[model samples]
Target: MASLLSDIRTKYNLLSKTQKTIADYILDNPDATILLSITELANYCSTSETTVMRFLKKLDYDSYQIFRVNLAKELIDSPSETINEEIAEGDSTSDIKRKVIKHTNTAVSDLEYSINQKDIDQCAEMILNARRVTFFGIGASSAVAIDALHKFGKIGLNVNGFQDSHLMNIHCSHMTSEDVLFVVSHTGESVEVLNAASLAKENGAKIISLTSFSNSSLAKKSDVFLSSSTNDKKYHSEAMASRIVQLVIVDILYLSVFMQNEAKFYKALNQSRIAVSLNKT
Candidate 1:
């Protein structure tokens, strides 16, 4: 929803001259463009409606109305955040800070566009109804797996996390149809994670994956997959950036499950807070 401007910028260099003019018009006048009808926008761009429609088609927008709706939300959410992830060697700490914030904001906005809310809701339903939940990940993704374990366990969901591939394989072999195996992988093609996911599926567990690539094997293997916007090749920053997306998705699913059963979850959550507080003082 909020990825319109980002998509425009990404495809800017590839656009035809006329399309580039349309791109410039939208990029420069997002607010005004949202208010203008398609013909009016075409008029403002000094282009025909066919050219405008063709431009939206390049962006994968099926209808002008939906394009405007998403574009309006994009403008409201992040009107001026230009996504620049490439950090040069001589960049200042301040520059790094700004770049990181901008990248994260843009990544999240891209996620808002790419991710499916229905899939999220379905995942929430699957998780909340599952007899037990298991999380699996490797390397950097292991941290997110453990975080999910901690968050869901605190709220009284039967949850565990396995970072060791061998352990994941062994544990997954025992999963039943009532089980939900939540896998975390940045690439979604991690060999170990996929092997374990396959094992879990063979044993009749519902698999849900959080990954950047929707077409990845892990995503294809799962009952539901949540897409993260860490699709860049910035080796130094990709892992770190994916972590931000991972944490946001985890929090969203966590909140979804909690809100669905607020009274019961609030009681469990309150008990957890009380128990943790006892050791603090």
Candidate 2:
């Protein structure tokens, strides 16, 4: 039922002994296997990164991130998938702790490879120059948009986040050449997001997107696209892993933008903290 394993089953005959060993661990203990880093996996298989890379090359996987993401999706999709996999319920608190860190670190590591420095430079510059900024997303992605709205608003950017699709579509009418619209979508193919983005473009707003794929429609619509990668599809909360990665991107952009006008942002940040402090007590 694991789609990735099924694909590998056909290629089983073609793999060398070392590749077969890696495949065996994946096919036999998929739940445990998915959590391992390339180094950890190699340790489990008694092999080296070279052999792991060669094995992945045989399977046609593009990168370790994509392979792990695809594997996670396939495991979740399997009707027979169990909560107690080979990783074991008996794993000590420390074992679980190490895994939690490694899993998160792996995702962040992928960001370095997927992110484009040039795109960030352009987007940060555009956001700084913009008269107004708006962010839009639906479902889990909406959380990302709202978070961006909060971060930027604190630095004195006139920012808005619309959680409702209808309101976002309606807001497109207000967009202008001097404004920047930041659309956050994990899959980058959401119809509601596309509708809003298209209408905003029609009104002459510059579109900036944070999405998982560079080739996605939202990317095509944007004047600049900032990418994050994930294939995590659990509960149809499609953006779960990508959401964390996107937040990192948001933080990077926030600092980059803030750095461009440090003195102005310093004053705005000070003012925001003071205004919000009134509610704290």
Candidate 3:
């Protein structure tokens, strides 16, 4: 079913001042609106109950109860209205393109605002100067860790990422003060990753956490914390946007490290090229 209050807002100019007030209240607090009786809604919006009844009828509902039931259904079915709201079908290609651009732009802007420059610099410096860098992640985050290892390794840094929990624990146990441990988790509360970070800490390794939330357990345990932001949808399906933010942070770290030690970075680059050329022959 269509959103009743959105319809009212779209036609707001046509609504009476009393109807408008009720409409605004319903839009702002949809869940609470569903729970209120017609009399309660009238009192809450400072209008007569007759106005509330008229408002529901104007929206094509047979009664206020039906209107509220439909609204509650909408809320229950879509917990995050920002992401779950349906887009109207477009009749032209340009209309579709415009919608796509708007969505992408919002995601990009969200990521940009969520990042902190100082955190990025600190993480890069720690990794660059460390004698060894141990990357830890599990499941989806493990893929990120492996990707980070590939980039950091190219810049002449010793880096390793482990997916297996047992292997991760074994590696963390060997980390020392001269080493750095980078933990990646979207939730920042993954049990295996947190345990690994704690073990690395016990061994005196400086820990850096890359997570979506700064207040997560992994972040609290780390020596430095870097976070990426994504607009969470109803199903928490912000993975695509979140991954983009994470990769951006990773790129920043990689470049910072490269710039901090330009000579070593370029030397490693040349060596990698030579090795690839030799293998191709």
Candidate 4:
């Protein structure tokens, strides 16, 4: 059930020039490529069969047929889902608004399809039982971690979000088997996040990762992994859609925990609401 398309997209930049050319063609016309033989695909890409075979090897496929089989399966699994959303030049405000809404809706829909209930249950249980929970992210991801801290902390959980690498490392150093670390990284390759996760794991804390890409370093290190949709559109490329999807997952986690033990957390939730409402003019 490994998705060849996801693998290709996740590692596209790491491929060689010839391999990228083949990858581009395949991504553009995956349905067509699935029906084509290796020679046909090579000719279509204006590359030789040897080059195509090399590209397959780069993808870690033993044979082109297996690669094609997985590609076909990916197409079947995803159907018409596309991460690339188009915003045309000289479009009106309404046009941009509609496109943005559609893209965000698609991302949320994909999350509903991508997340597994078992993973959610396990993560919720970990959060419920952990002595302390730590959230770690950097840059834009730091905002996400901070938001998670607010949500989880409001539930009476001993939670903290660390933005500084040194602070996160220090926190991890004091962590024990009763702690849980939740990491948010779109690429799962952030040096600071990885360092914190490694140190936390060494200190016997459970790690939960929320990432867009599967088979990433953070994903491999996590006790629980949750995937989100990619926001790779050319026009809005600052991970806008990806961040929304991640926040939604955080909301889901928060709700799951609250629903499981509403009586225990209800007072804290109402207090948070009352505290925020006090600021109203």
Which is the leading candidate under lDDT? Answer: 4
> What tens digits encode model 2's per-residue C-alpha lDDT throughout 58-104?
77876887899888987787634222122346878787666545444
Off by over 4 Å in 3: 1-105, 235-238, 277-281
The C-alpha RMSD of each candidate to the native structure, in angstroms, is 6.6, 10.5, 12.6, 4.3
> Comparing 3 and 4 by TM-score, which wins?
4
Tens-place lDDT digits, model 1, residues 129-209: 999999989988989999999999999999997777888899999999999999999878899999999999999999999
Q: 1-281, model 3: which lDDT tens digit per residue? A: 33554345333334667887887677657878888989899999998998988877767777887888878887787655423121354536675555444444544554444456787788877887799998878877877788899888876788888889999999999889999998889878889998899889999999988887666788899888776644333223446556666777788788888888798799998887787698784
Clashing pairs in 2: none
Using all chains and alpha carbons, the TM-scores for the candidates as numbered come to: 0.75, 0.68, 0.64, 0.75
Judging by lDDT, tell me the better candidate of 3 and 4: 4
lDDT of each: 0.82, 0.79, 0.73, 0.83
Q: Candidate 1's C-alpha lDDT?
A: 0.82
Ranking by TM-score: 4, 1, 2, 3
